[model samples]
Target: MKKTEPHSSRSQQLEGAGLGFLIGFAGLLAFQLLGELVVRLLAIPVPGPVAGLLFMSVFLLVRKRTKASEPEPLLNASSLLLAHLSLLFVPAGVGIMTHIDRIKDQWLSISVALIIASFVTLFVTAWSLKILIRFMNKPEPE
Candidate 1:
C-alpha cells in the first residue's frame, strides 16, 4: 500500500468539496428549470423556486422510501448551502428596500399579513414534524 501524504488528503478533500458544490448548484438550477416549466405549463400562481422545492422534497422522500443511498455530493452541497443560509435572505432584504414606499403605504396590512403568515408557517411546520416523528417511531406489526 502506498503511504498517503498529509497535503494530498487535504487537497483531495478540497477538490471533493468543490465538486460537490458544483453538482449541488447544477441540481438546483435543473430543479428550478423544471419548476419554471411546470408553473408556465400549468399557469400556476406559485413561484418556480417554490415548485422546485416541492419537487426536491418529493424526490428526497421517494429516494428514502426506496432505500436508495443518498448521494454524498448532494448532501455535502446542501450542507454547504445551508451553512450560509442567512446569505440567501440578502436578496429578499434588498427587495424589501426597493419596495419601501409601497410597504410604508400598506404598513398595517403588511404587518398583519406577516404576523399571520409567520404563525401559520410555524404551526404547520410543527404539526408536520410531529406527525412525521410519530410515523417514523411507529412500531412494526408482528
Candidate 2:
C-alpha cells in the first residue's frame, strides 16, 4: 500500500511507541531479575517478584522526588500496560495448562478453597476499609 503523509506519521508514532514500550518492559524486567537475585542470595522467603515490585516502587518514589520531570515514555508505557491488564494473566493461564493434570485431580477442593479464600479476603478488605473510613472521619481534639 502507498503511504499518505498522515498515515505515515501515525505509523512512525506507533513504532516509536513500540520502542518506548520495549524499553519500559526491559527496565521492569531488570528490576524483577535484580529482585530475584537479591531474594535468592539473601534467602528471603517472600516472592522475588514482590520484592522487585517494592524495589520498583522505591525507585519510582525516589525518581519522583529527585527529578523535575519523569520519563514520559515510561509513563505512557505503564498506562498502556494498565489499560490491558488482563493480558498479564496469560502466564497464569499457561501455568494452569502446565499443571492441568494436578488441577483436574483436585478441582473440587481447589474450587472450594478458592471460594472460601475469596470471601474471607473480601470480608477482611471491607472491614479494614470501613475502619479506615471511620478513623479518617473522626474529629480530633485541638
Best by TM-score: 2
Worst 10 residues of 2 by lDDT: 133-142
Candidate 2 TM-score, true structure as reference? 0.67
Per candidate, the number of residue pairs that clash is 0, 0
What is the model-wide C-alpha lDDT for candidate 2?
A: 0.86
lDDT of each: 0.87, 0.86
- Model 2 bad stretches (over 4 Å): 1-15, 94-108, 135-142
Q: TM-score for every candidate vs. truth? A: 0.64, 0.67
Clashing residue pairs for model 1: none
lDDT of 2 by residue, 1-142 (tens): 9756775887899899889889888887888899999999999998998998899889889999999988766677668878989999888877776888998999999999999999999999988877887799965333
